[model samples]
Target: MAARLPALRHRDFRALWIGSACSSISLWTLLLGNAWIVYKLSDSSLWVGVSTFASMSPYLVAPLGGMVADRAERRILVRVTRLATFGVTITLTLLALANVIEVWMVVSLAFVQGIIRSVEIPSDQALLANVVPISDLGNAVALTSTTQHGSRAAGPLLAGPLLATIGVEGAYGISALFALLAFASVRRVSVSSRGGVTRLRDVGENMREGMVYIGRTPEVAAIFILVFAHCSLTMSFDAMLPGFAETRLHSPSGGFTIMTFGVGVGALVGTFVLAMTTGARRGPLLLGTALASGISPMLMAGSHHVPHAAVGAILMGSSQAMFMALSAVLLQEVVPDHIRGRVMSLYLMSAGGVMAFMNLGFGAMADRTGAPILFFLPGAAFVVITLASIATGPYLRRIYRTGTAVAVAPAA
Candidate 1:
């Protein structure tokens, strides 16, 4: 336990972690509120996907966000984004209290929120790496990933009861409070290195340089491709959980909470395991767990009982966290500090932007073909992709073979 939590000893990293956790909590709450409200308003599964898409579309421009992360003062950037989130939540609360909230209004606000997220995602990630040393990066990444998936687990649980009693307006009101907490916590982070100093006029040149860097690095490029494929095919299916809960489980608002709870618990377990795992040789662990994650969806698709689905969620959540957490660690270790923000932005683009479109498509398909088929197809594809990548990508294998591949930066 002590070894896994070395990063906490650093004051700046500790502050950043708490702030990030609050941010994660707020983000998850916002997602739950949006999903439930949209589902209730339209009574159509497609609208749920559309609302998610509206909130995630900013991922498409994540490179620009990465550019800002690399060049701008990341601490201020994060605080500003949290304030934007606070504004969104407070406004939604007001509209809900007024009883004038419409479906279009919800979708429009979500779109605006997505724009803010594009900047927040990259800045937060970059700032995390900036605060921690190279040796503790893995633990830091695992813990941060926990903050996200763990919040997903807790957010809906809180939302379910709130929805049952005070309704969506009450939920948004709580989310507003969380957003304020996030803003306060982030204001405490103080990093020695703010990031690269680049002018706005050089934005085009900086972007081109970032692109060329990825193009020249095969191992890094492979990781990005895997990240994109993993998100678009496997992860995006999560957006359909509300529909699955209603149609498959036949449960009310509480169903989403149950499903997400299973995922969150599984992810927390995964974080613990990864945090304990030191040194390199994480290649097999990453690939093997991802394979398990992809295959678990089969169980989820076939589940008729709530417990069965929960078990599947646990398996999927743990494996998925291993895959993503390792990817974040490797990206941080391998990429130079100057371009790390831009590089990580590409990752966000895959995991966020591409996944948003996939959700939209999956939502439309679920309406026609049903959720079971949607789940099964993606699960099968995810398995196939992991297997194919392992067999063919010799470069990736070579990178993992060197047990201590973590690169150390020179002391300031």
Candidate 2:
């Protein structure tokens, strides 16, 4: 079992894994709580989009966050920022329990958390690279994502009970508890850098360097483009799910919880399978997952019941998890350590930015055209783009066929 899951053998990686799992669970639950509250308050899909948008809009400054990670002790930054978030979340929980919380307050809290995430995310990514050797990075990435996607099931699973019984305020309280756990869990991570204060150089130059390097590296550019398109068109459906659950499925919070939790279960199962493979030479599998990612949403488009929609959610989760992990492993293998944090930040920024803004548009579109169109159209566009990537780029096609586009992860 250790051989199959090499990353878990590392003590530090285990700590980071636990922290990330808790953090992800907190995020998904808080997001569900926030979106549900917004929907109840405004009764509009567009407002739900705004609530979701607040959760990721801070990625607009991802480069700065990246620079911070590169210049500082990545784990320390993550812990410190996580602590700050814990303080804020606790206060918010108190407010919610007092029955004084409002829609704007929830959205505003999400934005604050999002801003912190813009910094903490890159730090965690960089820190993982530091803790695990390159030979294990692929498995490490896969496993880390496993926690993220898998814990989504836990998040929404917890949310359903909490929301049904104690209300969204109770959801906020549980989310805060997770935040505190995230802060405590990372205390064991050893620092690797002297930190930003000592290594500090010209911030503007560093930021520009990260961008210029991506522009110069065609493979990285292509990957970022693909991630952006995939996230914006196919995966940025959090905003539309409210309308989809309430209007289309007619089950409200129950359907919403099932859909989100199913994604987590499928993602957990899919990425865990990939992690157990013991190598990165699975490009054909990656292509298949990417295609499945698009097709899954299309399946959701026709679903009229909870069970059917749950199946689609599972497929979407599994496919997206594999595709994302494979792409991340490939990028990590190629990018040098000097700028790893910056590049990783920008890479996620590519996904987050588009997803953030487009969520607003998706919400409005879901309102005007019905939630089903939101599902069908983005899936169709993603399929067209995925096919176009194969048609237009011989290099990309080769990666798919050989699975050797990146250095193979070592078999333990």
Candidate 3:
């Protein structure tokens, strides 16, 4: 096997990757801490969903952010976003320290963070292509997934103790420090701009072009459908996990941490395995992983035991990580550099925007039908979606015939 992680050979990519991992860790810490606090305060599953919705709803503006990303200097955009996150976290920390932090405060700040992330997500993904050669893009994306999942493991594990000892204020303080470090790290990455002084008029034109690009390209269009389905059907379940951990598993915050820890471990393993593959068929891998993701959640729905639920979490995490990482690799490889940011922003919108709306529904559904039904129904629907995509989606068929499609002509 040629080295498992060729992307790390590039210094700028290494710096960007490490910084992203730290930032991801901090974000997850904030999420878990906030979720746990909400659950403790309200004892309501709906609020947990609402908290997630607040954080992700800003993705409605992702297209605007994407236009900015395509036109602006990505490194500078990322730095500004991180700085915004730092301010939000620090303010939240101070609020918690004052012993007056309320659910509304958390939701409002999360909405602000979501707005910053609207810029950060696409800009960050678009910038990754600048740091590494095209040949190493897949490896870079996989490694990024590994970092994301690894941080998932570290964050919840850290959150429990931080909550028990230093309290929510301490957790937010630590999160702020991590955000500051992420901001500092982005300062070191240099990107050469190709879009050149984009006029305000260009945003509308660019947005239209991006929409046309997807509409005209079958393969690209299929990728977005799959991403949207996964996010809406499977990822929405994440917001309901705290209730599952407490009521179904009958475990405290510690058990919730363990289940998420299992998920992180599996995701790390899946990303590492994908990183090492030289001839993996992207279509079959994506379809199979999607099926696995669906099946795993169904397993959780049936499990009366904590270990089984943990195992289910791990499987779902693994499949989800692989699907997302591969989709990113493929999208970056195929998209024209000039419009990469806009396209990536659309992808982000598919994930964040769709999941944002679905989360509220999932929360409401869980309250009525119970969390297990939410898991079983969506899990079943995902498997059907994957199978249907395979039968109908031309992009998947192309992947099956060829090992991969690392390069497809950019859209008209």
By lDDT, the best candidate is 2
lDDT of 3 by residue, 1-412 (tens): 4477799898888878887987887787788777877777878789988998999999988988888888888888888999999999999999999999989889899899999999998888888888999889878877887887667777767776877777788778878888898888878787565332277576667788788888777778888888899988887775778788888888857667777777777888998787776455665677778888788878878866688888888888888888887777777778888788888899999988999989888876777777888888888999998888768877766765554654455445
Better of 1 and 3 by lDDT: 3
lDDT of each: 0.80, 0.83, 0.81
Please write out the lDDT profile of model 2 over residues 15-71, one tens digit for every residue. 999999888888887888888888988899999999888888999888788888888
User: After TM-score superposition, what is the CA distance of residue 250 in candidate 3 from its true location, in Å?
Assistant: 1.3
| Clash pairs detected, candidate 1 | none
Kindly report which residue pairs in candidate 2 clash with one another: none
After superposition, the stretches of candidate 2 with alpha carbons farther than 4 Å from their true spots are: 194-201, 278-280, 404-412
Superposed model 3: Cα runs more than 4 Å off: 194-197, 406-412
Clashing pairs in 3: none
What are the TM-scores, per candidate, against the unseen true structure? 0.95, 0.95, 0.95
- What value does the lDDT take at residue 25 in candidate 3? 77
lDDT of 1 at 354: 88
